[model samples]
Target chain A: MDCISARSKNIKGKGQSKLKRRESLAGLLFVSPTIIYFIVFFLLPLAVCIYASFTNWNILSPNRVFVGTLNYERLFVDPKFWKALKNTLFMLIPIPIYITFALLFAYACHKNILGQKVFRAIYYLPYISSIVALTLIWMWLFNSKYGLVNNFLSLFVDNPPSWLSDPFWTKWMIVIMISWKLIGFTSIYYIAALKSIPKSYYEAAQIDGAGPRQQFFKITLPLLTPTTFYLLVIGMIGSLQTFVEVQMFAPDGGRGYGVGTIVFYIWQKAFSSSQMGYACAIATVFGLFILVITVIQFTLSRKWVFEGN
Target chain B: MKRKISPVRIIVFIILLIGAVTMIVPFAWMLSTSLKEANLVYTIPPQWIPKPVDWKNYIEIWTASNLLTGIKNSCIISVSVLVFCTFTSSMAAFAFSKLSFPFKNAIFVMLLTTIMVPLVVLLVPLFVIYTKIGWIDTLLPMIVPASMCNINIIFFLRQYMTGLPKELLDAAKIDGCGYFSAYWRIYLPLCKPAIVANVIMLFMITWNDYFGPLVFTHSESKQNIQVAIAMLNSHYIQQTDIPLMMTASLIAILPVLILFIICQKYFTESFAMTGIKG
Candidate 1:
């Protein structure tokens, strides 16, 4: 009765109060589930990770010990941290080359040359296969004594290097496996980007007497700036989180932190060592590290990522 | 991608062909070795062909242990995850793309921000929470997380939705369809390609992932196929005179590869929506 009277009185104001409040209420109700989920799952978990970094909270523990800055202090001095950081950097080295190959692969398929569908399916196999299985296969393939790679090399080179066993070779092996897995999906992305570039652009360039080489450089490359920029940002972020390949492939807990990329190192600390506090700290730092890079990438993309419009 | 199809273009094709072959060999090798005798697996030049092809590996692996049970467990987990993720994400995508929700931009931004937080960062803390809920060693930990709509998937559906003509939606509303009804009757059918891609991608992730399955499952009966394959040394890889490991690997990757092959077209298209399109 009170609500009815209020609405009826507000009717004198005209054209407003009858549906306005109800529409606002409906909108709130509609978005509530997703908002609740984000708060509980995404936001809360992040907060927990950040706070857990400051305190020693093991899964088995009865209570968290407030360790304060100790986790942070230990992370800085840890040589393993330095090695993992280096390994993480090395993992990113081949990404640009990988992206180039991806573009070539995409362009090939886009142009409809040479059993294109078959080729894309073939390229995409590794990406979709079980990573653990793929890593294990790579692990066996890199076997120093009897593996496929070394065995092939032995017909010419005397002592084919121990790819997984050695620290230096371990980095290369990880890079190769990572590249093999990602190239196809990324290629598909490039193929889509290529297709979106209408033929009119190329026709216009050709009429201006621009040959294929000149057309690619002047037209194709420039228009492709947005896609490439997107690839770089996502690719870098993805590569930095490269965990499973190292976790499974480079054995002996990934060779004394040699191939222990940031993620692998976190796994080592949290799961292997039971240093939950310090692991969370590493994860927190790593998150911030990635956050900074992504912010820079997004900022850069403002100037770099071109609008199709 | 340098230039036109010259003599160099032919050379590029050759190089790409070789690379593609290399990409596929691991899987082909996996399948072939599955049917071979164990002794032939490590032979010179890594035997491409096996003699007296032993097909018993599949039966031995499946029947000698609780692998069939594990396979069943994996299927249950993966299918459930797939259904939940697809349904929830499509709904979320609908809300983001169509409905005039309050603070939609803010919510979208918040969702996108999580993509930067690597899986590593979330794993430990999430582990802690799972342990609290006594979800360790059960499929719930893996299954539940799979439902938490990823930003990439939502954004993907959103982009595809954005490309769709708004008139279809407006016309539905004019004929008295509400938001959910229009989404169900209109967008659902039109977005079939994108939805299929999303399902295939998520299904592949769940089906092939050893990471979550490794942590969440422990018993051989609870193990997924990848874990089963990787832990070959324990299961049957050590059993000489059989190609059991190979058989398991082949069985493990078959479903996902088949799905990927089936959805290859849509996968390529919707994947482009994510990035790399001009």
Candidate 2:
């Protein structure tokens, strides 16, 4: 019996090791499909965008000329570039306002008050809803002559301004629409972050004579710093890459370069103007900008986003 | 001090309720407009309630705009992509979580870094490649890329898998199960929530993605709902029969919304997971 057991031990050991190796190999094999897919679709295209950045390759023209930094030069001198930057910033400025509101909404939800779930679902529907639907609704709602928003506003003032027609109001309407769409998603993050803080802390705060406002400022806000940092990083990236909404809203936008972000500008240059090289340069610069901003944010996050300490 | 559920709170709720109503009203308006007579849709001091319903516009768009074909194309593409992406990712995730792979960390890091690469950069090159391969119009671009060892899915499932009990897997192995058997029987069933969340996210993404459809698909018959609807309202939105366009847009969004409503917990959890994990 002892001899039989010993023989089985050695056989089992060898078999198991072999199985492990095979399993690992199979795992690698399974993932290779994805790696290859990424290489062909993502990495190769990325390489082209980089290479194209250094040349004047337009899809329209057969012949391509090498031009280093000329596209960058053109971007710097162009007023449209600044306008695009301004438009992006203009859109971004409202994020903090909405985020503050989201935090409040999340706090209200976290309180587990009456009808919390209903409020949550109501607010959150817009976030998950197709942007196409949201945009269409907003377009109708913003109609100059007869729209819901204007009609609602007319109740207060004798005449409601033509929001869609006016250039100044058009971007603001877009920002308002985007922010409303975003707040629910943002609020959920805060709610999650809020939920994670052991209830004991808040209970203890209450014992220590901390009021609602005091607890919020001292405990809730500080703990949510990490969430805020994360949201900011993602928000900046999304705002920078804000393309589709602008494309739909400002198809025939006003003046030079129209009301667009850097991404929109790149889209126009690449697809519309057929200046692949110029677009690539814009992409490179945008990528660099994102990199720098991200680095600074992560560095700054050390002070506020306390993962452990 | 801010009031808690007082008259002020009631007032605030009323205000926010109004806001929420405004937010939700569009869908109702879209539906009504779709049902209303075409002439009644554009009337001044606009008729909130029309005298007669017009099913003809819905019929017209469905038939004239090739919406059925568009919807069929969308369903085929989204479902296929979902299956492929889910299968490949879970298999890859099985390895990441349970098995000991050499050079695993390095490969994982490479995938993570690629997440930052702007998708726009891939546009021109993929266009050339797809055109060369004669896959420009077909659904290959959408499906092939949709399924694969998605880095996000891998990480998500990895985190979920690692948290699972080692005992379950060990017991399975002890019962004469191979690694694949243990993975299939033990791990995959446990990771249902992650799979559900991932599916919902992917559905929303693939369904709503305008760019990929715009570039890859040309014919209205081949296009997804997003592309098809865009073609309907592209050149001039206001000039179009506003009611019909709005209804079509609502219809386009309905599938994902229905999915989301059913899986609200997963959707919320997914968003929460991103924050916590990131």
Candidate 3:
């Protein structure tokens, strides 16, 4: 009887291992396509980019000479690169202000204000629209001569700044356009975050004689930190990569280097100038900047981003 | 309990109203300008409403530019990409969530890290590779790479699938269903909401993608609506026909606007889900 029990237990263990093996095979089979794709597109391209950053290879050239540290050194000294970096950083100014308004707008929508649904949908319209079309429309609106904005501004100011043409106002124009497009989309996220907050917390605050303002600061604000943190990171990364508006509005670096973003500068170097090596080097550095910033954001998020109880 | 019409609510309403107007004015201006003649566009007061609307600009622009062909190409490319990306991402998500595999965590982490590698970094090498493979001037470069996988979609679906019951797959397996069938019949059916959400999101990404088409396709006929519209400014830079540009912009945005309105619930809800889950 002891031998029989031991033999059955051994057979059961063998069957379980076989099942595990089959499951592993099945898993590999399921993920094979994605794995193949990642290898060909993601990994290979990344490998090529890293390699190309160290070489002087134009796209048309057959030979790529190894030039270690040369491209990186050039990037450090290049005034255009610095200007582009500054321009990219300049766009970060609106993010906090944008978040504040998005939060406030979301709060109002959460309270079920009149036409809340309609307003939310309307706000998301620009997000859905093509960036090219949106930029062109904005171009028309920012026209120095016949623009609706300037036309409106002429009613008070003697000289309205040329939004698209003027170097100083070019970054501001892009900022305004970016803000307009993102406000609706970001606010919707905040609205969802606000709604997810348990009503019981607000009720508890009220029971403790907390006013609406007190409830907001003490309860709602704390709860919304995770969402805010998410937006802040996303917003910063996105602003750093601002391209279409700046590219379309200020095609030639916006009348004396007002709106040349890092990506746009990279595109100009690689595509227009055919300086593929320099572009790759710039791209590598820009990517590292984004990575560093993102890592810092993640590290900082631990302090303020509320982990739900 | 009856809620009072508080002054705070009134203030909120006014603020939101102002925002709504700001949002709507661009489209309104586009429409207004598209109807006005070239000379009438630069009026002092700015014609909020055109005296004599010129619908000819739309007709003329549509006939002259690659607008119609662009629309057709954009629809085909975006739809194909949408379907392919959704399928591949979902399948991968299923494996990650349900199946027991060796080195699964390591593989997923590797894939996630690739998201940090921005598209701009890949631009030069991809351009060189595409040129080598003779994919430049073709839609294949744009469609094929984008279709293969999207990290965000996989992450989203994986997060969703993790919340699902393990017993469902177990029950299916107990009923003599194979792993593929479990995925196809059980998991796929259960994943409709997620799939719809992914579809809408992918549609927006593919449709709004200007940079890809612009870089890849050089031919006039192969260009998407965005490229076509952008070409309008370049080709007619000296002319500066604002009305024609506005008309083209209107046409370009119409499909997305209609789709957004129709899928309003899914569009908003999907974005909302991403924010919370992400």
Candidate 4:
């Protein structure tokens, strides 16, 4: 009887082991396509990009010769690169302003105010619209002669700036265009973050004799830090990569080449100039910049963003 | 529950009212310009409502260029990307969430790392790779690369699937259902809302993308609506037919507006989830 029972137990153990093997096999099979895709698109391209950054190969070049960081050295001295970098960084000036407005709008909406849903939908409109179309509309709106912006401004000021043509206001125009589109999206995110904050906190604060103003500064602002950090990082990354809007508004980079962003510069270099190697070098630097900034932001976020409360 | 309207409430309402109008003016203006005659576009005081509205600009722009073909191509590319991406990402998400495998954490971390790599860095390399594969000027560059694996989508879906009952999957296994079959017959059906929400978001991203189509697609017929409009913008600027350009711009955004209106909830919800997690 002991020998028979032991034999049955061994057979059952084998069956369970077979099932485990099958499950492992199934897991690999399920994830294989994504794994293959990542290798081909993400991994392979990244490796090639890093390598190509050190080479002097054009689009149709038969041979690639290693340049030993020549592209990187030249990039630092290149006026166009500096200009592009400046333009990229300049686009981020509106973040604080955008976040403030978004917070106020979100707070107002979160109050269960009149036309709350309508306000939310209206604010989010530009975010969902095609950027190309919106950029085009803004181009018309910034037209020196008949633009709605100038038309409205003309009523007060004798001379309203030519928003698109003038290099002076080009960055400002780009900032406004980006902020207009992003405000709604930012507000929506803020609203979501606000909703996740428990109401009991506010009730407790009120019982402790906190005024509405005090409640906003102490309770609301502190709690919303995570969302702010998120928006800041995302906003910075996006601003640094400003391309399509800049390209659309100023196809030639506008007067004195003021509106040329880093990504747009990269695009022009690669596609138009066919300087693939140089473009790759710029892209590599740009990518590293983004990654480092993101990492720093992540490291620093713990100081401000409340983890539990 | 009724309370008197405070002055602060009135102030907030006024501020929101102004903000709402500012938000909407662009679309309203785009639509108004689409209806305006060429001469009416540059009036001394721009006409908010165009007199003797010309609806012909829409038909004219459509027939004049590759606008319709661009729309068709956009639909084809986005839908394909949507279907394939959703399927593959969900499968990957399922593996990450449900199944135990060797080096799973390492692979996931590797995947997350790549999300920080800018697409700009990949552009030159991808162009070369695609050219080598003879995919330049083809839709494959746009569709295949995007459909490969969206890190964001995989992460989102995995977070979602983690909350699902593991017992259901176990029950399927006990009922003689294999892993793939269980995922197909049970999880896919159960995750329909999530899948649909992801589809809308992916569709929007794909459709609104201008750069991929601009670089990868050389032929006119292969271009999407955003690319088509951009090409037309430069041409129409020289053509000096502002109304035609405006008309094209309006048409380019129509699908997005319609989709957003229809699926605003899903859109906001998806964004909310992304924000909270990220």
Ten-residue region with minimum lDDT total, candidate 4 chain A: A162-171
Write one digit per residue (lDDT tens) for candidate 3, span B1-278.
Answer: 33459887887888889989999999999999999888998788887899897888978997877898898889889988998888888888999999999989988988978777788888778888888899999889878977888888888888889889989989988899988889889887788998897798898888788998988889887998898898777423677888989899999888778878888888888898889875
Clashing pairs in 4: none
Q: Where is model 3 more than 4 Å wrong at Cα?
A: B1-3, B234-236
lDDT of each: 0.76, 0.78, 0.86, 0.86
Reference-based TM-score of each model: 0.90, 0.92, 0.97, 0.97
> For candidate 2, lDDT tens digit of each residue in B1-278?
33367764565566567756755777677777767765676677667776776677777777656567778988998889888888888877777777777788777777776767777777776776787799999988988887775777778888888888888877887798876778778788889988899888888888888888877878766888887777665345345777677768778878988988899989988877866776
TM-score, second chain, candidate 4: 0.96
| lDDT per residue as tens, model 2, A70-131 | 88898788787788878877778667977887887787778654566878888888888777
lDDT digits (tens) for residues A80-184 of candidate 4 = 999888888898888887888899999988887799899999998888888888888888888888889999999999999988777658789888878888888
Give the chain B TM-score for each candidate: 0.87, 0.90, 0.95, 0.96
| Better DockQ candidate (2, 4) | 4
Backbone clashes for every candidate come to 2, 0, 0, 0
Candidate 1, after superposition: displacement of residue A241 in Å? 1.2
DockQ of each: 0.51, 0.54, 0.75, 0.75
Residue range with the least summed lDDT across 10 consecutive positions in model 2 chain A = A250-259
Per-residue C-alpha lDDT of model 3 across residues A135-235, encoded as one tens digit per residue: 88888888888788988898999999988777679788888888888888999889988888999998988999999999999999999998888888888
What lDDT score goes with residue A279 in model 3? 91
